[model samples]
Target: MSRKATITQKEIVNAAFKITKKEGFEQITSRKLAAAAGCSTQPIFRIYENMDGLKKDVYDKAAAYYEDYYNDFNKTHEVPFVDLGLAYIGFAQKYPHLFRLLFISGQGTGGRSMYDLVNGSTENVVKEINKATASGAGNAQQLFMQMWIFIHGAGCMAVTGDYDLDEASSVAMLESAYKAFCLG
Candidate 1:
């Protein structure tokens, strides 16, 4: 009789996620995943059909992370909107490899644009933007689009290591963009 498999899907994904977090998705070899999971390579294949399957699982986890947890920029800054922008750049600087996977290489999201991810994932902050801009929710969304342009630019530059901006300057630029949108 064949032995029953014991490893779960969550375990496999978690192990892959950890490796991807540190080394980017390319490091997710069968041996590395097995070592991380404390199991043989057989179990990884048993749980996932192939590396691409495992990658898709990890990609979902990463997407959910930015959508839910990594977006908490409010703890550092009084203004949630500012926190949101700072958080993007900080995430890029902190996770340059992962940032490239998410934004630059377009590993996930099925060719959806970054603006879609920004707009879709950022509905939580519309209320804060509304309050800051003293505008209706409709106008606040427009403001978010403008602010996102600045934030996304900095984030792209951050991962490229081309423009190493300090916190003060980033905040000033975001504020300026916000003000520009609010004016008209």
Candidate 2:
């Protein structure tokens, strides 16, 4: 009888993500990822056309996790845009390597857009902005793009060891920016 397959594509992708989170995205490889998943490279190749496919899957999973994280916060409490900015910083601080992989640096050969990393999160933030603002003159998408650029810039600076603003200071800065853009 044929031996039962003991590995799965999701397991491989999850292992790859864990590897990336622990040892930076630059160090992740098919062989290392396969080892972490406790499977041979053949199973990885069977599920994914190549490493690029695996990378894309990893990115997708990360994005989903990020979205869920933000959504969970929303469900628990009503946080402002500035609070979301603080959460962004917290995430980066907590997972410096993974944060770099998802935002600061681009990985894989799939030509995936950086915007994909924040797709769902950004959408939810925009919806909150819309609800917070009653005028509704400008489009939420445009406002979200502007706020996202600001947040990403600040977050990247923090992750790259460039900015040293503390949590309170960061929240203040984000609040100021949100007022200027989303509220004003």
Candidate 3:
């Protein structure tokens, strides 16, 4: 029998993910993925029916990476909610292409809008905000949504490089806006 193949589907998908991270999802062509994977385009076709299938896998990978990256601060920080907000903005600034793919281009919503996805994921965040605001979690939905809108705006600006935000000022903004939304 012939020797076993050297590369696997996961490796190929990971290479595609790296390319998506650097160049955005739209740039994930067969050639680009092949170049990133350090192999010919044959492996891509051998593993996936087409670029779309590979792209779908890549999207799933990126979503998981995004969630993991954001959730990393869940236990480390004293103020996990504000820390998560800062992490969101930091992710945008650090990975603009991934940010565009995840937030602006809207490639991986699975038929749901990003707004819906974000709102749906805010259950835990609402609980955190409730703890911070001394309000009940059930009552913090609107407050969390408001904070999300602002935090996401800052991330968008970071991705676009239109505004250079400093941490101190962002912290101040987060504090004031959070207080207003949570108490008002």
Candidate 4:
């Protein structure tokens, strides 16, 4: 009688994500992942051509989850900018390690796609600013850049415990900064 294996591709990916989250991405290895998944490296190699492929799959999965979080907030709120800022903080607080990997640690190829997601969200804010200001002299691109910098800086600080504020206070400060950016 032939016995079927219990390990699967999804299980492998899930194990990889858990390992990376707990032990940082730099430490991830196919053998480590295989062991974590309770399988041999052959399964991983059969599912993914190489380490890069596995990493890409992991990054894409994380990105999808991250995007879903942001998209859920977007669907519930009318103001995309404020919601995006809150989402930023929420993501950082909820998944501190993943947040660091996505934005802080300079790892993987997903950074460009992550930037595009933020840029797309910021463009909506720029549109709002344009509508509010009614001034052709102001540059939306520049405004978006400034706002992104501020939001990212705040998010990094909050995630890294550089700031002393509690969750409520940190979110409030971020909202205030966003509103101030809109006004200026």
Task: List, residue by residue over 1-184, the lDDT tens digit for candidate 2.
Answer: 9887899877998898888777876688778878899988888888888767777787777766666766665332233456566667767766777777777666623554655455463575655566545445366566666778888888787777777888768877876776677654
Give the true-structure RMSD of model 4: 4.1
**Which number leads on TM-score?**
3
Q: What is the C-alpha RMSD of each candidate to the true structure, in Å?
A: 3.2, 3.6, 3.2, 4.1
Residue lDDT tens for model 3, 1-184: 9766777999998998888888887888888888888888887788899777877787777766767776663434444256757878888998888777777875764675555434335455655665665644345667777778888999999998975868777777777777677567
* Candidate lDDT (C-alpha), each: 0.74, 0.70, 0.73, 0.68
Runs in model 2 with CA error above 4 Å?
74-80, 106-122, 135-143, 181-184
Rank all candidate structures by their lDDT, best first, as comma-separated numbers.
1, 3, 2, 4
Give the TM-score (vs. native) of candidate 2.
Answer: 0.76
* Pairs with steric clashes in candidate 4: none
Q: TM-score, each model?
A: 0.78, 0.76, 0.81, 0.72
Order of quality (TM-score): 3, 1, 2, 4
lDDT tens digits, residue span 1-184, model 4:
8667678889998998887677766688888988899998888887888777777777766666677777676433333245566678777766777787777866547456456655444454555456435544255555556667877876787677774566567556655665566568
Query: In candidate 1, what residue range of length 10 has the lowest lDDT sum?
Result: 71-80
